[model samples]
Target: MKDAPLTPPLCSTDAVLATLPAGAGDLPGAMIVWEGALYIGTAPGAGEGGHARILRLPWPGGGAVEPVYEGPEGSAVTGFAALDGSSDAGPALYAALAAPGGGLILQAKAGAGAFAPVTEPGLGEAARRWIGPLALWGGRLVAAAGRAAPLVGAIGSAELLIEADDGSGTWAALSEPGFGDPGNVAISLLTVLDGTLLAGTVNPARGFQLWQAGEDGAWEQRIVDGAHRHVASPALTACAAGEGELLLGSGGAAPTAADLPADAQPPELLGLDPATGWELIAGEPRFTPEGFKVPAALEGPGFGWVKTARICAILRDGATITAVLAATPQSARPFGLPEPGAARIWRSEDAGETFVEAAALPHPLVAAAAFDEGLLLAGLAGGKVRLRVAT
Candidate 1:
């Protein structure tokens, strides 16, 4: 085995977009390039309390930043998604805000109108429920909101909700734990592949489960990992190499115990086919690249993982898929990314068979996008954004 370099940089950060002013929210979340603008949602940063901000930067220059939405206290933007305009509902942007002491999902017209809450009544207990990512499935906006953190006793539950894009108030619970897994407490990811909606969950008792549903709302569940106490399997992206294929990233962990330390099991990357089920891509890791050492915690069978950063965003360029990773600590604090440096970007050539660290961004990376001018936009921690010109 060749020795891997200690610190390898992947892409070069060449330009700066905008730096947040003092008291502005820092951690950026779900980002979507819709119409001709790039929309970025943010989470509360240090000393901000519970405030969140949504910024819009135009494409060509992407210099002038517009505060699309400035949320009130106790509000943090969690996710964002865009719906292509139709005859009924014009193009609109949806945001999932961690409010309600629990979570709230909101929507607004593409380029006009202010964001308004669209969450259903009596979904879960306040302060405990939180919504995961958002996606548009079969013309309807969909998201998962459930009970995740508890003050005491057992953790609560989660459910999938659907709302029309035409500004109607028809909010409904598409499915519940009774409709799927009773132990699913948090829905981490909601994505579409081959016209099917895929959902990933974080389960405390049963690890994580991946669910697939059609337009009719019938869901089929599959257990992907069951060894860890909390399986933070939220990252999901399409495979550009193969048609209708999907890649799922799992952040596994074993709860703190007397003899066992709170092990941050390296994130797992799995590939799913329309025909075959979920297949472990890095189950038997080669650790081929030099200077990359398999951490002592990730050394056993099916544990030889490469990327330790939690999967944030996956960008597919041609046949190569780039996985953007973040280092969120186990203490549950926000943006544990190192100072003066950023997160790692890993590239895979043959699907998920292997991954090589490509480049590094300045500051911890929360979201990324490819611009029309052949530049990559990376949203970093501390309200800073930059552009990566080349790989």
Candidate 2:
């Protein structure tokens, strides 16, 4: 039989946890639970453009929201990574910053201290303008350098891979796996799985390519060479119910000038096993996944199929894994969500092979993090937070 639906905890003076107040033009970006607190990154909203802020809030119960770091004006925190500090030290945190002239990488020691710019001085200039989110590989911090934001066109090129030495804070560019456009390739996704570092590039003109680093530190590249032009979500999660299986999520292409029907391109979830390679587990390129299929009863005016095309975030919950996804209109604004759109959660059993709609959330759920105690914290694009208890 179907079980009770998972819902967020009730918010009250005593039961409520800490909350961060987003200003008039502040959009929350990536969020992660680390070091006994909730860290959230905020991007400058429509009318407010400047340096972004990272706020830290004590977790589990209630506390004051404090600004851990305030970036320079005209910069935003693109992504964050938790460091595996040396045996003598506690874990640290790293933030990836996107600025007008170049990118910056900041590192903060444990205990929510001040963040310091760790990006090598000349490295950002050598790497074009912007840096994608940072990830860790074999104890090294990795970031992809790309061209600064384009006003009315697509970026033609980006740096392949750059690694920073955790001990010395020195940065060095690495040899490409020898794939994608030597000039125009930019990394669109970065994550780690079972100690292996996985990277995906943004090459809409030639299709998205996946790069993997093996134990020997060798890199291999594969092109998804399919109808989809990009891999919208690149995430890794493990299922604990049966023999552990690693699941990878990817799908959706940004609408290009050609004006393709994005609604028809749905995100796909794949499972990777060492014995085998990649196998499709959920979603089809041309059709919506069964669990997220929009019911006829909920259809309304301005309802577009954009949400199923992308998988936003994936988190583990008990015996199942939950994915929060959204669908919006094709004409929706790029930096923000449409007024009222569809953003919902889906639960998957059997390692993402199938899923069931768990709950529908406010539109444009941009970021999500799962706490240790079955609590889910999500950051919406409209400067709001959603909290839920995994059932």
Q: What's the CA error at residue 83 for candidate 1, in Å? A: 0.9
The residue-by-residue lDDT of candidate 1 on 144-262, one tens digit each, is 76555211124645677777555665557878752466666566668778678877765545567777885566777643443122333322322222445676555532110000112
Clashing pairs in 1: 3-290, 3-291, 4-290, 4-291, 5-291, 10-358, 10-359, 10-360, 11-359, 101-127
State each model's C-alpha RMSD to the native. 7.4, 7.2
Q: lDDT for every model?
A: 0.54, 0.52
lDDT agreement of model 1 with the native = 0.54
- Model 1 — which ten-residue stretch has the worst lDDT? 253-262
Q: Candidate 2 residues 252-365, lDDT tens each?
A: 443111111244244555555545444455534333222233222232111223445455556654456665554543344466435343445666554454456666554344
**In angstroms, how far off is 325's CA in candidate 2?**
0.6
**Where does the lowest 10-residue lDDT sum fall in candidate 2?**
295-304
Candidate 2 error regions (>4 Å): 1-19, 46-48, 87-90, 121-127, 150-152, 156-168, 182-185, 215-217, 226-244, 251-264, 285-307, 317-319, 329-341, 370-391
| lDDT score at residue 65, model 2, on the 0-100 scale | 78
Candidate 1 stretches greater than 4 Å from native: 1-10, 46-48, 118-129, 148-154, 164-168, 178-180, 214-216, 226-242, 252-262, 284-309, 328-342, 366-391
